[model samples]
Target chain A: MNPVGRIGLIVTVTAVAIHFTGVAYAQADFEGIWNPQHPPRMGQPDPASVRLTPEGQAEYESYGPDKDPTLRCLMPGIPLGLVDPYPLEIVQQDHQILLLYEHFHQVRRIFMDGREAPDHWLPSIGGYSTGHWEGETLVVRTTLMSPDNYTWTNGFPYSGDEDAYVIERYRRDGDELTFTGEVHDPRYYEEPYVVNGRWNFAPDGEIWEYECIPEFGGIQ
Target chain B: MLFIGFSATAHHNGATYFDISTELEHSDATVVSYDLVNPHGRLVYVFMDDEGNEVEWRAELPSANNARRRGLGGDLFRPGDRLTALTGSPSRSGANFMRLTRVLFANGDVAQITGRNAGVVRAGTE
Candidate 1:
């Protein structure tokens, strides 16, 4: 073939390759608004059921309602926000997964671009999250969370702070998504605490804005 | 790097605001008003004391978003509407303050406004 014919064939092959790649990424559909099956606030776990260290037990017992930081309009951190009453939206891209919770308008990003956690990074309430897909399940690992943050509400300490670790597995079955999370904090619990919940897909549902007005009863 | 707006609303520890150890006093009262605002919803009502004197009661519920989701909106109540409430026992023996439990409207409408124990009421409260 002539030079022009050869160039035309190369362009056609490149276009086909790009189209197939786009289709491959689109196959993982975890995007949409979802509501947890049961949003747990109170009656989550009895103190006896939680295996706490001596220091952890003292911290939990010292939690005073008036001194609660969340009442002052602070972040409730992980697991608590995961099963909030308001719906959360999941937006997946090639490089990351974004979680947008309706309550307090919290947003969490799970990087999927093959980056390792940085050393001596600043602690964050949302922590540093990295995710990978295992077949249909998306497993996420989060670390470097702020020590001041609470793993579960009511003063469940996440004292691990810089060393705090969280692993979450998200699996989608039809329109229902299940979240199984494990939190490990050597400074708090004697063992990893498990968190389980479900979210149903809501195509037409929208997570309304949660504008917190202090002194107006900002509970969560 | 994309951060979405987060409002510090909903999911506060109820134990801090309420005395959960004591039983909620189930009483029949009249809906004086309901402020369906953000942060939290307030329900104002009046009930009769042991001596038959009128006692005003103000209770807090979940956020407007959760209330709206449970079919309890601004239009749900009006002044003079009869309601059955499970009120939180006051910290002091005779304090007039009461926290709210599930609310039963005169029209047979029931809402678990407290945001917990959904669809399940105390064995005898229902």
Candidate 2:
């Protein structure tokens, strides 16, 4: 081959390799066990900051620790489950991401296969999650949560109806993971509820089995 | 290495059951039973009142796993083990219940069971 032709081919191959490497880097790797770097403070929103509607205000007023579903061993659901003071494992696959929490043995699957919620889907505590990657952050949108659940911020208020939804952004930087979320429920609040949390990579961390028996202490 | 940042935020709100602002102390308490379980660990013990009457108290500790990591074992407090000091938040309902915070073993060891200073154990008399 001519010298100029050989040089051109080499340049083309190197450019292709670099491009693929950039693509791989863009797909952040968040698969590992993570221990919370700080306490997961989900529902501790400032009462003055939260703009609750009349229904939400009424529900907040009626809130009591005795009525906390968690005391009954009910699943804490989204923001609460995500911020619990326990270790969690993140497993990423080509089509979905799985979050395995040591709290209440909760497991959440975030579908990435471009699927939509069924028209007649039943609401659940964990709800339905769909995720996509933008740059190095994983953005997830969750909906169809059960209305029976509670949102703990300034006060423990009932979660809004089926229309309640949550949007979460997860970004990993070195050994640190940052999470930000927005809870939207027009029925409950005049503004979206926002929360932030952080976790550190636990190289030797393991998720243990969680068996919640509400009658353990006989206090209830 | 010890893991920190496991906050006091557990399954239920502690304020609902205990008066967190007040601290109650029991010295030379005899352990009746210790159930190391999830959600929270319960420690039942008996101490003498000012009138020399035996009083039974139930104190809540962290989960079994968190307790283990903080140097508490199932056998750490046996049926007859004596605690040099047991301090916690008293129950608001006027019951003999508390949210355990610090435990001082008869041998001088100390375990901070909850709060910002949780997961710390100081060896004593070894």
Candidate 3:
């Protein structure tokens, strides 16, 4: 059970906060300053990504969806790399915005500068994301993500390691901004997986300083 | 401190604490180096570095082929088939507790280790 789910206030406060942002938050407006938070809860499961082959099913069954190796501050590997349950700062400059997740001091620098991705050797974690603006929407295509699907403790399997791609269409509809992510992993996936995630920009906040120290336990 | 979550977690590399690094400068003990005696049964232990160079140590760990030994990834050794291995030591002088992150051999070879079992409690000189 989610700790904050009991409060009921977080949902109200978060929704109200999103409501006050006026109209919708466009990509350029959100490019400057933003704080991201993922409270502990079982959000909507993307069934589109759930369709896997027998081998893929085996991998996903090995662990639950929340495979948090970093629970004890262990090494954070593929998947939980960005979807950490904490507030992160998103700093946008020109076409580039930096995503800094607080789980284990992990940060990913996304390039909006239209450069071609390298050869077939990029490993997935956050993957390689390049963004482009279409009117008020920021369209980002992320490739090179390592495929397996148990980032923390959850054992959800992505389609495949080599052929997975995420097309994130970020739209700011007034105070409520929506991020529609499409996952395409060809090996195990028979079709394109889609997820429409929504968020509110918290300007009245600061990204909490999170540090993971596992030297003694060496858990991280 | 692993965090738990369900569906929709971006399946990327979960954060590991190895890179962030810790200060680890604790002033809790009055003296620095204290002897570590085993609280459990006797243990045959050896202190090895990353290069597998055996360093002089107090505890005695058993052989790798021992019936009670378990291997973590990269040749890390564990006793009792669990992440926490209780090696053979004398009485309690101090404790050498370690997380199951990595283990070093007498020849200085290092292996991955984890679990919060390596402890070194401070002991007042008898």
As for candidate 2, its clashing pairs are A43-A152, A43-A153
TM-score of 3: 0.48
Model 1 Cα displacement at A159 (Å)? Answer: 0.8
- Name model 3 segments beyond 4 Å from true: A1-27, A32-42, A46-49, A64-67, A72-82, A148-152, A213-220, B1-126
lDDT of 3 by residue, A18-46 (tens): 66642223346764334332322212244
What tens digits encode model 1's per-residue C-alpha lDDT throughout A60-133? 88865544444556666664454555688999888788999887888898888667678866777777888877
lDDT of 3 at A7: 73
Instruction: For candidate 1, give the DockQ.
Output: 0.28
Candidate 2 lDDT tens digits, A1-220: 9999999999999888766543222268899999866533333555578888998889888866566666677778875565767788999986788988888889999887667788988888888998888898999999988777766623545474767798999999999998887888878789887767788999899888877778653343
Error of 3 at A112 (Å): 1.5
Show model 2 residue runs off by greater than 4 Å.
A1-26, A39-43, A153-155, A217-220, B1-12, B120-126
DockQ of 2: 0.22
Q: lDDT tens digits, residues B27-126, model 1? A: 6788788777666777778888677888886767667787777766787667888876544424332344544556665555566655444333333456
Error of 2 at A10 (Å): 21
Task: After superposing candidate 1 on the true structure, give the runs of residues whose Cα lies further than 4 Å from its correct spot.
Answer: A1-27, A39-46, A218-220, B1-12, B15-33, B79-97, B105-126
DockQ of each: 0.28, 0.22, 0.04
